[model samples]
Target chain A: MPDDQLSRVFAALADPTRRDIVGRLAVGDATVGQLAAPYDVTVQAVSKHLRVLEDAGLVSRTRDAQRRPCHLEAEVFDLMTKWIERYQRQAEERYQRLDAVLARLQDDEQQQTDPDEGAAS
Target chain B: MPDDQLSRVFAALADPTRRDIVGRLAVGDATVGQLAAPYDVTVQAVSKHLRVLEDAGLVSRTRDAQRRPCHLEAEVFDLMTKWIERYQRQAEERYQRLDAVLARLQDDEQQQTDPDEGAAS
Candidate 1:
């Protein structure tokens, strides 16, 4: 119901059932009946899951006779990928910077003690 | 807490405030007070967000004197990226298969009409 696509996408995938449905759709499109066949839940419940996926733009549907086949829209995944990658890269860079700083400090400390330990070496 | 790491990670990121906190932490680690400076929320609320992030394995923390610095765990993003990519690739492959099938159907139709249309050509 919200316009925040990122949040919607994450929330849409928070449930295992929804994730499973997405997986099945990825292999091929299916009507709600077909998607619900393997689940113990009612068709109405499966329909609700489809609605959530549809709202998140992770899925789309088209009318074919009386059936509305749900299709996976892989392009929607780019949004999540970009967001996750941006943060992941930043975090990794920060960790690398910290490591570099620690290495520099160790080098500085070694230099400071080099003259004192010259005879020992 | 649920043992579902993927769900927890997704649920943690479902909130805009939490996502913003993650984005900030990605750039560098920060204390709760420092992290709370940019947001209108209280330090307690920010702490709660941090706890959720910690539970989701998206963040880690260390005690330094009286301060606890929160660090972003970028490796957790791989879980999400892998899940999203799996479905995206499957969907793309399915689309390609469908296209190939359609192309073959067209070729078969063309072959059937070739014998009759020979004089017209």
Candidate 2:
């Protein structure tokens, strides 16, 4: 996905209601009425959230007029998963490198403090 | 992290500049001036981005007088990773169940079409 679409996906999921909607959709497809029934919000409000999700490619509504069920597009989650894992892995590797450096420094300090012991060994 | 903080984190990363800052910080910590050097925007703008990141617990700025470098707090990524993976797993399982149901239906259809073959076998 392009950076713009990724931004849109993040922005779309930033809302608690929208995230809840996505969670519900993950279990099964639901119409706007079904989705809005749990929340006190109006159907229009829920529709707006669905619109954002649709725009972000996270959700898609079936064209059936009577029952326009919103389906969770699971593939879009891969885009976010990939982006987040990239940075997370990089940060982890950096920490591992730092740990190795610290360990080396401690070894050097130990050798300096017991030079005679090191030579005997 | 709470839902509010997760929202904040998602909102913080919605901007391309903020995501870029995060990607840079993943490599190593950098002062606001250093982070803003590559962008056309002013240091103040970058500081604002960092503020959002800090609010979300994704980045922390050291209190050093010479350079308040921003460090990436990698733990917060776990919250998002967990959230995304939960829904992704649910959706995947749902698809798998649907595929199984379809496969059963296909087997049933095949058995009906070749009733004599099944009896012989």
Candidate 3:
């Protein structure tokens, strides 16, 4: 539930062609035909991939006369970034704590192994 | 071609169980057995999930005597954030240009529809 948007974004990027589509759309808007021209896949297949990207909120379409141009929506990227950064920060904080605990444990072990080492020093 | 690390991270998060494991590890590090106890799936299944997360660089394990405890690696998240943000920024800049063109087209249409509207106003 928490990962709904991130899930969609991730799933959209899962396919290589869709990722390529995204890469192209990133540079500028393109019609389905224009976007599909570079690939061996049928226009229908490209359409399907665009549909997935659209559903994922990564792509948006607008009518340009007879052609429907797809535009990439960059704001949705923040959804994934927020999610990633949250967990990343959490994990790093956990790692820091783990390091502290490990250091304490090692110090305790040293104390046990060499009780007089501290006194000698 | 641009999505190598992003793919791994997305594919890793595609599994809910693994995402849950990540969430848990985010709060604190846990042993494999501890991570497995909450799920109905066998310890083996959870172990496999951990392996997936491990391969994706989302999770790391450290030996503690006979037991291996998994810790979340926050650094890897940057790889994905970078990718997502890059395309996102691209799309947004493209959008600005598209918007400018759209506004120009709208102005042209207005001029054509009411030829003397500009002169009258």
Candidate 4:
């Protein structure tokens, strides 16, 4: 996915209400009314949240005029997953390297201490 | 881990510049001056981005007053990874279930058509 689209996806999910809406939609598609039922917010408010999700390509609405249920677009998650995993893996590897260096230093210290202990004994 | 922190993390990465900074930091820690070098933006601007990242716990600055290199906290990625993976898995399972239903319908249609072929033969 393009950087702009990725930015939109991240921005969309940044809101807790939108994230909750997405969590519910993952279970199954739901009309805006059904989605807004649990929240104290107005349907209009929920609709605005859906607009953000739709713009981010994280959710889609069916053509049915009467009851256009919101469907979660699972594929977009792959884009985010790929981006996040790449950096996550890189960071983890760096940490692992740091850990190795620290371990080697500790081993050297132990070796030095072992010889000192022998001399003292 | 907490919803607020997750929100901050998502919001922090929403900007392309911030994400790029993060990608670079994952490879190794860098001072704000180093991070600002690649972009046309000022060092102060890069510092602002780092502030957002620090608030989100995605990046941290060292105590050194002269050169506080930013470090990528890989653990925060775990929080985002878990959130995304949960919803991604849910949506995928839902798709799998829908596919199963469609497959069953196709099987029934084939069975119905087979009897007609037998009668015609």
Candidate 5:
């Protein structure tokens, strides 16, 4: 529970139910009742989940006359994607560098262990 | 809060400090003391964060004699990326479909409203 939007966004999606609701909303916008129907949870429970999503700016509620529909803000996904990709790419690059360094070290060790092995063979 | 691996991963990364630690570990593995040196918090606090990351399988600590070094499990990043990509793609497709439908409806409306106007002009 960090206060930042990225933290909030990741925190909001930590729940399976909330993630499922997001999946359903991605297909189409739905009312809280409609979103809640598939789960065993109550409408209030689903509304609570929606509140978390809304707080994270991942979901927005629009007044459709008497009913309010929850719309998925897919653009927010870009924030999470960017964060994840930055670290993922950095980690992969580091791994590659580590691999190269290890390979060179292995070659150096071999050269030191048997300086004349190449000529003998 | 959820028991699933995806939930655990997202929940573990929800804290800013935890995410920062993950970023650092991504560059290379380090001892707990080494990891804690940069932060103002106690080593115990950093250990707690490491434990959360370890529980989520984003990191692993290997025993090298008495010292355990924390290594980033880069593969776990794939889970989060896949989940995010699936929903992001779905939502984008839905948005496109909605756009097409709206455009068609607008055209139909114009045709209905001015069926004779086009011919008259």
Candidate 6:
């Protein structure tokens, strides 16, 4: 898939099934068959979902006999968390600035307080 | 085009250009031409990208003469936040349970403890 890491991660998680698989893997590592047992989908389909999760770096697999047990990599959660926090903070900051601007405008209409628009109150 | 909301949102954000546009919109409402100015891409392509964001409910445009200043609907961020937090929380909960299981296993192997796999001590 032609995607950035963020895209890969978001697209990987866009599926409810893949999110569930990640959920199960987080509790403990499990073989593909074990992961597939709860879902009605074929093993191959679940395998594909795991592949997407793997590509997103959300999950990793190790061999044990013929089974490939998948494990969740918690570190990748930080990537999404950081991205979300950054934008959320920015949006909130913008909202606060807008509020200040509106207050200043109201003050100007009243001709009451001489607030410096550029100053951070 | 034939995509679920989650898919549409992801595909809309798959482009870095679109993400930048969204970031700028989060800061303040801007017209299509203003959004398109920073990039080398044609305004038509940027308009197409805005259409994607609009369909995803990330951006909303309203009439201002011939201009449609795009506003970021902050509620949409909650949609993504909810999705991300659900998976992230589930993953963290799973990790805690796994830690308990592993500790139980280690204890079983250690002091000749009767570690019932089904029972929690």
**Residue-wise C-alpha lDDT for candidate 5, range A1-121, written one tens digit per residue:** 5789999999999999989999999999999888988999788998899999999999999998878899999999999989999889999999899999999999999987686776677
TM-score of chain B of 6: 0.86
lDDT tens readout by residue for model 2, A55-95: 99999998777878999999998989899999999999999
**After best superposition, candidate 6 residue A13: deviation in angstroms?**
2.0
Candidate 6: residue A5 Cα off by (Å): 1.5
Better by DockQ, candidate 6 or 1: 1
Local error of candidate 1 at A101, Å?
1.0
Assess every candidate by TM-score. Answer: 0.92, 0.86, 0.78, 0.83, 0.93, 0.81
The 0-to-1 C-alpha lDDT of every candidate, in the order given, reads: 0.91, 0.92, 0.83, 0.92, 0.92, 0.81
DockQ of each: 0.78, 0.58, 0.53, 0.62, 0.85, 0.37
RMSD of each: 2.7, 5.0, 4.0, 4.1, 2.7, 7.1
Give the per-residue Cα lDDT of candidate 2 at B74: 91
- What tens-digit string does per-residue lDDT give for candidate 1 at A38-63? 99999999999999999999999999
lDDT of 6 at B18: 80
Summed backbone clashes in each candidate are 0, 0, 0, 0, 0, 0
Q: Candidate 6's error at A109, in angstroms?
A: 2.1
Which ranges of candidate 5 are over 4 A from the true structure?
Answer: A116-121, B116-121
For model 4, how big is the iRMS in angstroms?
2.2
Model 1 complex DockQ against the native:
0.78
Where does model 5 sit among the CAPRI classes?
high
Candidate 1 chain B: 10-residue stretch with minimal lDDT: B1-10
Those runs of model 6 whose alpha carbons end farther than 4 Å from true positions after fitting are: A1-3, A37-42, A112-121, B1-4, B113-121
Residue pairs in candidate 5 whose N, alpha carbon or C atoms collide under 3 angstroms: none
Residues B1-121, model 4: lDDT tens digits: 2358999999998999999999999999999899999999899999999999999999989967898888998889889989999999999999999999999999999999999989998
Give model 4's DockQ, 2 decimals: 0.62
**How much of the true contact map at the interface does candidate 1 reproduce, as a fraction?**
0.88
lDDT of 5 at A92: 92
lDDT of 1 at B69: 100
